[model samples]
Target: MDFLYLLKERFLPLSLMAIIPIISVILLIAIWKKKDQVSKMMLTFVTVISLILLISSLVLMLFTLVIGYNS
Candidate 1:
């Protein structure tokens, strides 16, 4: 089907975008379990980084959807 073909074409970028949320979830879980100030601070820093990544990924995805790729 046409939809399937389109999905295949966009799979790589979409999958890459998906990875950020998965990582963010794992980081959040780690943060919840962590207790020490030092470790918690470190995990918080990493979680912030993941948040930035998620935002950038969203922007990139939107841009790609609007502008599309060269055929």
Candidate 2:
């Protein structure tokens, strides 16, 4: 039970970090399938933001991992 809690603590953030791009892609697909122009536009904006967040998070994670590995 304690190990499960520790595992969740370590993995949850990494999993969520990894899922950003996937969620963005799913959002983009949903937006594309939407027929309403306004809804599509809103989702497009969200997709862009999600992409930015995904990229930033990936870069940050990579840098941190490299630094930690070296140390």
Candidate 3:
């Protein structure tokens, strides 16, 4: 039971990381299937959100690298 708990604690972050790509793929499929104006708009919104997330993650990663190097 203790081992399971420890595993879960370690796995939680990894699971969350895995979700981002799944969500991105689902959003891409939705965008591809979208035909009407509202759907297209929603798809565009999702694309923007995904791009923002990508950029933010990249910036954070770069910051972490810089900080790590300085330390």
Q: Which candidate gets the maximum TM-score versus the true structure?
A: 1
Instruction: State each model's CA lDDT, in order.
Output: 0.71, 0.64, 0.58
lDDT string, candidate 1, 1-71, tens digits: 85576567777787777777777777767776764655756877877887887788777776655456655
TM-score of each: 0.58, 0.49, 0.47
lDDT of 2 by residue, 1-71 (tens): 85465445456455656776677667767776774665757876877886787788788555544442231
Which stretches in model 3 have alpha-carbon errors above 4 Å? 1-30, 33-38, 68-71
Ranking by TM-score: 1, 2, 3
Q: What are the per-model C-alpha RMSD values against the true structure?
A: 3.4, 6.4, 7.7
lDDT score, candidate 1: 0.71
- Candidates 2 and 3 compared: the better one by lDDT is 2
Candidate 3 accuracy as lDDT? 0.58
Quote the positional error of residue 43 for candidate 2 in Å: 3.5
Candidate 2 Cα outliers beyond 4 Å, as residue runs: 1-16, 35-40, 69-71
